[model samples]
Target: MTTNRTVQTAADAALWLAVHRGWHVLPLNYGTKTPLRGCADCRAENTDHTPQTCPCLARGDGALCHGVWAATTDASVISRWAQRWHTSVWAVHLGASGLLAVDLDTRPGPPPRHPLNGLPWPADEPPPVDGLDTYATLAALSGGTVGDTFTTDTPSGGLHLVHEAEPGRWKGSHGKVRDGDDTVRTGLGWQIDIKAYGGYVVLPGSTSKAGLYRRSSTTTTPLWRPDWLADALARTGHDRTATPAKATSAPAPVATGGRSGPRRYAVGALRSACTELAVMEPNSGRNRKLFRSTTRLAGMVAAGWIDRTEVETALAAAAGHAGLPAGEIRYALTSGFNRPLPVPDIRSAA
Candidate 1:
């Protein structure tokens, strides 16, 4: 077993390793995913729930804040933080740092096998090999040898598979695989969480509440995203497509019609439209803009071109990022259908 001091040393080394390698890092609590509390200035700025225009990010110095905005690669800034918060764990900002971490958790058991066993864990299973099945499946799907990619064993008996990711909109998922009977299985199972786009992961040497994570002896250069892995993850609903729908791509003009005839396009067309709208600029009148976007999106929805849930989910993310109030965001998304858009004139285009 690695001692606490050794674990601490490993974490420090890992921080410097990532920093030297050009990855921006964030300081998290020693044993938690939560980012360390924001510095006084950031906290003061975020006091209100209203959409904020915090200067920390714009300043580009990477001073201090709780979430993704705290990422930085400056050695001096990191040294200062290291001195001030020596016990802090390192969490790489996934999307911003150009890294993707596959967080594989152990499949917790139903109840304690023994009376003295307080936690609900599989009694028969050995202590360290809990998530092997899931890990093996990912390894096979990820198109790499055991030592060909960066990997780590989490302190709490889980795993982290590291991969290099291009700077873009890569989505992540906490997905599960299910058998015909719908019994959830491993590899896309509930126990796995792909940490990407708006997520972070603790590096080797970081101590979690459970214990310290240590890197395996087989660390290697991180590889670019693999095709097989991408498709599997996408089908499992945890990945965003490689090509983001450009915000400039407008939806197909709504044709005059209703449920009266077969729809001109499938749900895919609407999905594409929503994707484009999602990446559009969140202007000053974000509410009005969202309302208008939703209006166009819902037009497709009314014609049965897309599912409401999908449209709502996509638009909600955009609205939330734009700083719209929760109630207003919801209203903007739902109200579009109430004022249905006129179907586009297919003949006019001809």
Candidate 2:
């Protein structure tokens, strides 16, 4: 993988890949916007959630890079985006940055906020020049009254919107802290920047959006990959596949949702899975707490784990996996405690 290039970020490249692959995902708000917490001073006008995580902290910039990651089944989409940007797997980073900048500029609210009160293209008027490059478009926006202008974001989180003309020469990371206790392990990140936008038969002649670019991380080395990122990427479809370049004697873990470990085999796995019934439970926290007591699961009542009414409350208070049904239990273990997971019989247990 080649490295060393201009304005690159992990998130930018990932999202860009999705866009190129004909996939578009939700974007997260970073550095504090509205509705969303950490993004306090988002566009500050029409604060919205875009799907980005701050990567600045990883850059040792003492901050996070606020951007989003999109989803897709096409593994090659990311690669293709990176290639278009003349970099590695980093188009997502570029795409996100470009979008965030646009988002910040266009946050919904009445004017006169003094910061980012103007629009890149007037609501009534249209883009002065069609197909402007990312830089040119930013320059126009930052040019005052002609384009978009982001003025004031609370400095507390480091969410100062940079102009396309004045690219901050940014040397730091995001302004937000991570959401989990477990450290995120990263092997390599594809850094990207919004270089330009192009090719649009449908993009209105009045609509002017530029493309983005990204490069592999060469400025600084990425940390923590062997344990967490390796699994997260494959499991989440971030890397698509980690096929080995050379055959090794050691076996690789199968990408199955869950596995059967030695010395631990439960009966009724198929029956539990086939008939397992789960419900959606929403939550927000540093760590995800399973809410079994609060909601009654299909097998919870039959298994005698708890009363139907007590399901929601029990699940909310649930800590670790002990004994739920095989399917429910495994599903929970695999995907955010989807529902109660336990084997049918415990020989003589509650």
TM-scores of the candidates in the order shown = 0.55, 0.19
Off by over 4 Å in 1: 1-11, 41-53, 110-130, 138-147, 176-187, 241-350
Give all candidates' CA lDDT scores.
0.57, 0.26
- What's the true lDDT of residue 10 in model 2? 35
Per-residue accuracy of model 1 over 65-141 as CA lDDT, tens digit each? 64765777777776666667665367777777787777777766531111110111223543333345444544453
Query: Which lDDT tens digits does candidate 2 get at residues 1-350?
Result: 33333213433433443455332222222212111122333332443533342233233221112322332324454344334433322212323233212111122222221111011122333322211221233334333221223212221211122223212221221111134322211111111021211100101011111222212122221122223212222321123223323212222211222233311222222222222212221112211223222222434444653344333323322322222223223333333323344434544432
Model 1 steric clash total: 7
Would you list the clashing residue pairs of candidate 1?
A: 176-188, 176-189, 177-188, 254-343, 254-344, 255-343, 255-344
